[model samples]
Target: MALWGGRFSETPADAVFALSRSVHFDWRLAPYDLRSSLAHLAVLQSSGLLEDSVAEPIRGALNELISEVAAGRFVANETDEDVHSALERGLTEKLGAIGGSLRAGRSRNDQVATDLRLYAIDHMIEVAQQILALQSALIAKASEYGDAPAPGFTHLQHAQPVLFGHEIAKHVQGFSRDLDRIHDWLDRALVSPLGSGALAGSSLPLSPEVTAKNLGFTSSAANSIDGVSDRDFVAEALFTLSMVGIHLSRIGEEWCIWATTEFGWAKVADAYSTGSSIMPQKKNPDMAELARGKAGRLVGNLTGVLTMLKGLPFAYNRDLQEDKEPLFDSIDTVLLVLPAVTGMVATTDFDREKMALAAPLGFSLATEIADYLVQAKVPFAHAHEAAGKCVAMCEASGRQLHQLTDEEFASIHPSLKGDVRDVLTVHGALESRTTVGGTSPSSFKQQIKESTAITAAYSKEFTDKAKAFSEMMGA
Candidate 1:
C-alpha cells in the first residue's frame, strides 16, 4: 500500500507510477534523506512528540537502514514511489507500529528540500576540490613557463608580446573567481528547510535550529512556505557550474589552438590525445574538444532548471520534482570533465621556442615603438601615427620591424633612429612594460608568487571546510 493511500480507493496507474517514481535518479539522495530523518528524530524526541522509548527503537531502525544502504544490501523497489516512501516502508517493516511515528512531524516536501540541500553542499565541496586541482595545474604551468614570451591577441590577431606565464595567469584568475562564487553561493544554500513541514510550520513544536545545526547548516529557513519552495540554491549552483564550464571552455579553446600545427605553441601528451582513424600521422585533442563541447550541456542544464522553476507557485508543487535531475546532471557533468581537463593541462608540453619565435612576428613591437615616441615628448596621437608608418613601410618592403633600415626608421619619425632597435626584440618589448601586473620578468615573478599564495589560502579554506563537513556527517 502507498503511504498516502488511506484517503483514496485506488492506487496510481502503472504509467503514472512510472512517471512519478524518482528512485532511478534520486537514489543518490538516500544517505542524505536518512541523515535528515535522524536529525528530525532528535527534534521530535526533545519536543515530546515522540517518547524516548519509541524514539530509541526508531533510531535503531534508521541506523540499521543506513547500514543496509552503506552495504548496498538495500535499494528502492518498483512499488516505492520515492526515496522517502522507500525508507518509510523499510522503517515500518523493521519496527512495526513505532516506525510509522517517525513521520508525525515531517513531510516528504521538507524532507526532499533538506536532502537536496545536504547533497548539494557535499557535492559542492567535491566540485571545489576538483576545481582546486585544476587551479594547481594552471599555477604549475605558469611557474614552469615564467617570463617566456608568447603572442597575445585581440580579435584573433597578434596585438602584443606577453609572458606565456601571464597568459596562463589570466585563466587562473578566472577560476579563482569561480571558486569565490561557489563559496558565496554555498552560504545561501546552507539554510535548512527541515522544519517547514509540507507548506506550513509544523504544530509539533520541533526545533529547526537543532536539525539545521546537526545537519551542518548554520541557520534555518525563516519562512515555512518559502523554505519548501525555494530552489534558488540549485539555480545558483547550476550558474556557478555553468561559469566553470565557460572558464574551462575558454582554456579548452586555447588548448585546441595551441596544439594545432599552425600555432605550434603547445603539444598535448599522447596520453591525452587521440589517433585519427585512417590517418596514421594525425593526433587530435579529443580531451580538449570534449571539454569545450560539454560546456554547452552544462549551460543547457542551467537553463532547463530555471525554466522548471519559473512558473511554480510559492509553496512546494509537483513541478519541484523537475529540479533534481538538472541539478544532478550539472554536478555529474562537471565532476566528469574537470579532472580530464586538468590532466590535459598538467601534462601538455609547451614549445617555448616556437612561442618566442612567433611572439615578435606581425609587428607586435609596434606598441612599444609608440610608447618609445611617447617617452621622447611626442604626443601619443602623433606617436601612434609614427608607429603605423613604420608598420606600413615594413609591410611594403616585405620585411619585419626589426629588419627596417635606420633611414627607413628615421623617415617615420626623427626619434626613430637606429636606437629604435632597442625596443624591437621580444625581450625588449616585454621588459619595457614594467608596471605592476605587466609581462616583465620581475612583474611576472611577483604574479606567480601572489597566485601561489592565493591558491594556498583557498586550498586551506577548502580543507578546513571539508573537515568541518566531514565531522558533521560523522564520517
Candidate 2:
C-alpha cells in the first residue's frame, strides 16, 4: 500500500520504487515511528478528529504492532518504501479504515524528523554510557599505575619524567569533555517535530505539545517549517560521535606503539589481539588498529552528512534521506569500538620496569637541573646554560646526568655545588612537580579521585535521564 498515489492514475514504476525505497536502512526506525503514531493518535482523539471508539482500537492495534515488531513477527515488507510506510500499512490492515486517520496531522517529513530524533536520543544515551565505561577502565588503570614514573614525550621523544597514571588521565580528560558535548547535544535534540505537517503544519486544531510531551520531548518545535526541516541534531550527533572516534583512535595509536617490540612498554591481551597468518610470533593489536582505522570512517560519515546538507533549501529535502545511513553507521561503529578498546585497556599489561628505565633517557631531567640552579639564586639564563653544558658534558663522556661526579658538575658550572645530583633521580623529578594536576604522587592520586567522581556523576546523570525518557515514551 503506497502512502501517496491517489492523485496518480498509475502506480510508481519498479525503477522509481527501487530508487525511492529506504526500508532496507530505515526499518530500524519502526519502533520510534509507532510510538510517535500512538502519540499522534491521542492528539487526534483529543482534537475530535478520531472518536474514542476508533482511537482505542487503533491504540490497541498500534501497541500490538509494536509488540509484534519487537518480537520480529512484523517487519517491513519488500513493497514498503520505509519504516513509516510499513508500519502504517500494518495499522491500516488492522483497523480497516481508522488506521489511515492517524496520519491526519503529521507528514513523513515531520514524522521522520521526530523518529530520527528519538532514535538518536536513545542511542546517544547508550553511546554516552559506553564512553563512561571506557573512562572507568582508564581510571582504574590510572589508579593501579599510580605514581609509576614514565617518560612523557614531546614529538614522541622523551621530554620529561611523568607518572604513567598522569598520561592515562590526559586521555580521560578528553573523554570527559566528549561526555560534556553529548550532554550539550541532548539539550538541542530534545524538541519534537511531530506536529509540523509537511513543513507548514495542519489546518486542524492539533496541539503539538500533547504529542511532544507524550514522546518525552521537552517541547514542540516553535516554527512549523523548521520543525520538519531541522537536522542540526543529527549533525551535532555526528560531530560528537566523530570526536569519540578520534579519541578512541588516539588510544589505539598509543597502544599500537606501546605493544611494539621496540617500545616494549605494554602488551595487549591475547583475547583482544590477533596472531599473524603466516608468522607464528605475531600478537597483533588488530582491534586497536581497527579502532584507529574506523576513526577515518566516522569522520567521513560526518563530512558526508554535512556536504549533503550544505546546499539544500529550508524544510525537508530528499537529500535528508542521506543522513540516516551515515548517522547509523557512526553510532554502530562507536558502540562496537568502545567496549573492545575498554576491554583491551583493562586486560593489557604495562611493563613498568621498561617504562621507568626509559623515563630518564635523553636528558629528560635537564629541566630539573635548571630549576635546581635557579633555587640557588643564580640567574635563569646562567642556570639554563649551565644545565645545557651539564647535558653536553654527560653526552661527551658517555654517561647520564646523574652519573656525573661532583667535580664534573663543578667544572660544568660554578653553581653546581654540593648535592646537585639529589634532583637527578626519577622519583625526585616526579615528586618535584607538586603543583595541582602535577605528576607527583599526591597530585596524581587527587586526579584519580576527581576522575572517579566525574564518571560516577555523569553515569548517574545520564542513567536518570535515560530512565525518565524511557518512561515518558512508554518504552
Candidate 3:
C-alpha cells in the first residue's frame, strides 16, 4: 500500500499507480529530499512539537540513509512512488513506527517544495563551478592568443580586424553576465518552504526560521498559501538554464563553423571530435552539435515548466508534481553540457596563421582608411567617400588599397599619403585602434587581465556558496 493509502479502501490499479509514480524519474532527488527533511525535522523539534526521543532516532536514520545511498547501498522498491515513500519505507524497515512519527504534521505539498529548493541550490553550486571552469579555459586560451589578429564581422561579413583572443573574451564576458544571473536566481532557491504544510501554514507551530537556517535559506515565506504553491523558483531556474544554454549554443555554433575546413579557423582536438564512417577525413564537432541542440531542449523545458504553472490556483495542486521532472532534466542537461563544452574548449587549437591571412582581406581596413582621412582634417562624409573610391579603384584593378601606388591613391584622394600603404598594414591598422575596448594588442591585454580577475572573483563567490551549503548539510 502507498503511504497515503489510509483514506482509500482499495489500491490504485497498475496503470493508475504507474501514471502517478515519480520514483523512476525523481530518484536522483533523494539527496535533496533527505536534506530538506532533516531541516524540517530540526524545526519540528525546535517548535516543541517533537521530543528528542523521537527526533534523535529520526536524525540518525536520515543520516544512515544518506550514508547508505552515498555508498551505493540503497535501492527503491517498485511500490515506492517517490523519494518520500522510499525514505519512509527505508526508515520503517530499520526503525519501526518510530521512523513514521516524522510525518505527523507535514504534507507532500510542502515536502516536495522543500526538495525542489534543495535540488536547485545544490545544483546551482555545480553549474556555477562548471561555468567558472569554462571561463578559466577561455581565459587561459586568451592569454595564449588574445593578441593574434583576426577579422571582426558585421552581418557575418568581415568588417574590421580584431584580436582573436579579444573576440573569444567578448563571449566570455557574456558568460560572466550570465553567471551573475544564475547567482541571482539562487535567491529564489534559498527560501525555505518546509513549514508551509500542504497549502496553508501548519497548525503545529512549526519554526520556519529554524528550518530555513538549518537548510541555508535566507528566510521562509510569510504566506503559507503562496509558499507551497509557488514554483516561481523552478521557473527562475529554468530561465537561468535557458540563458546558460543560449550562451553555450551560440559559442557552440561558432565553434562548429570555425572547425570546418572552409573556415579553417580552429581545429578540435581528437579527444573531443568524431570521425565519419563513410568519409575518410571527416572529423566532426559532435560535442558542439550536441551543445547547440541541448540549448534548444533546455529552452523547451523552460517553456514546459512555465506553461505548467501558468494557471494553477493557490495552495497546492496536482499540477505541482509536474514541476519536478523539468527542473531535474534542465539541471542535468546543463550540468552535462557545460562540462563537455568546457573540455572541448580547453583542448581546441586556433589557426593563427589562417586568421591573420584572412584578417587583412574583405576591406577590413576600410574604416582605418576613412579615419585616416578624418585625422588629416578631411570632412567626415568626404573622408567616407574618398575611402569608398579608394576601395572601388582597388577592386577594379584587382588589388588591395595597400597595394595601390601613391599616384593611383592620389587620383582617389589628394589627401592620401605615400605612407597610406604602411598605414593599411595589419599591424598599423590594429595599433591605430587605441580605444579602450578595441582590438589593439595593448587594449586586448588589459581586457584579458580584467576578465581573468572577474572569473577569479566569481570562483571565490561560488566556493563560498558551496562552503555554506556544506556547513548547512554538515557534510
**Which tens-of-lDDT digit does each residue in 1-475 have in candidate 3?**
3778888888898899988998887787788788887877887787777899889989999999999877779878898998889989988988898888888677888888888788788887889899999999888887778778988888989999888888888778878987898888887667887788877777788788778877888998888888889888888888888988999998899899899888998889999999999999889999999999998898999999899889887678887788888888888899999989999988999999999999989988988888888989999999999999988988898988788888987888899888877778788888877788878888888888888888999999999998888877764
Off by over 4 Å in 1: none
Q: Write the per-residue lDDT of candidate 1 for residues 1-475, one digit (tens) a residue.
A: 3678888788888998899888888888999988888999999999898889999999988888888998998998878888888888899888887788988878888989999999999999889999999999999998888768999999999989999988888888888998999889888999999999997988889999989999999999999999999999999999999999999899889999999989888889999999977999999999999999989999999999899889896799998898999989989999999999999999999998899888988888999889989889999999999999999988999998888988988887898878888888888878877898888889888887888898898899888888888777653
For candidate 1, the lDDT comes to 0.89
Q: What is the lDDT of candidate 2?
A: 0.92
Stretches > 4 Å off in candidate 3: 407-414
In candidate 1, the residue pairs with backbone N, CA or C atoms under 3 Å apart (3 or more residues apart, or in different chains) clash, namely: none
RMSD of 2: 1.4
Clashing pairs counted in every model: 0, 0, 0
Compared with the true structure, all predictions reach lDDT values of 0.89, 0.92, 0.85
Q: Which stretches in model 2 have alpha-carbon errors above 4 Å?
A: 379-382
**Who is ahead in lDDT, 2 or 3?**
2
Question: How many steric clashes does model 3 contain?
Answer: 0
**Inter-residue clash pairs, candidate 2:** none
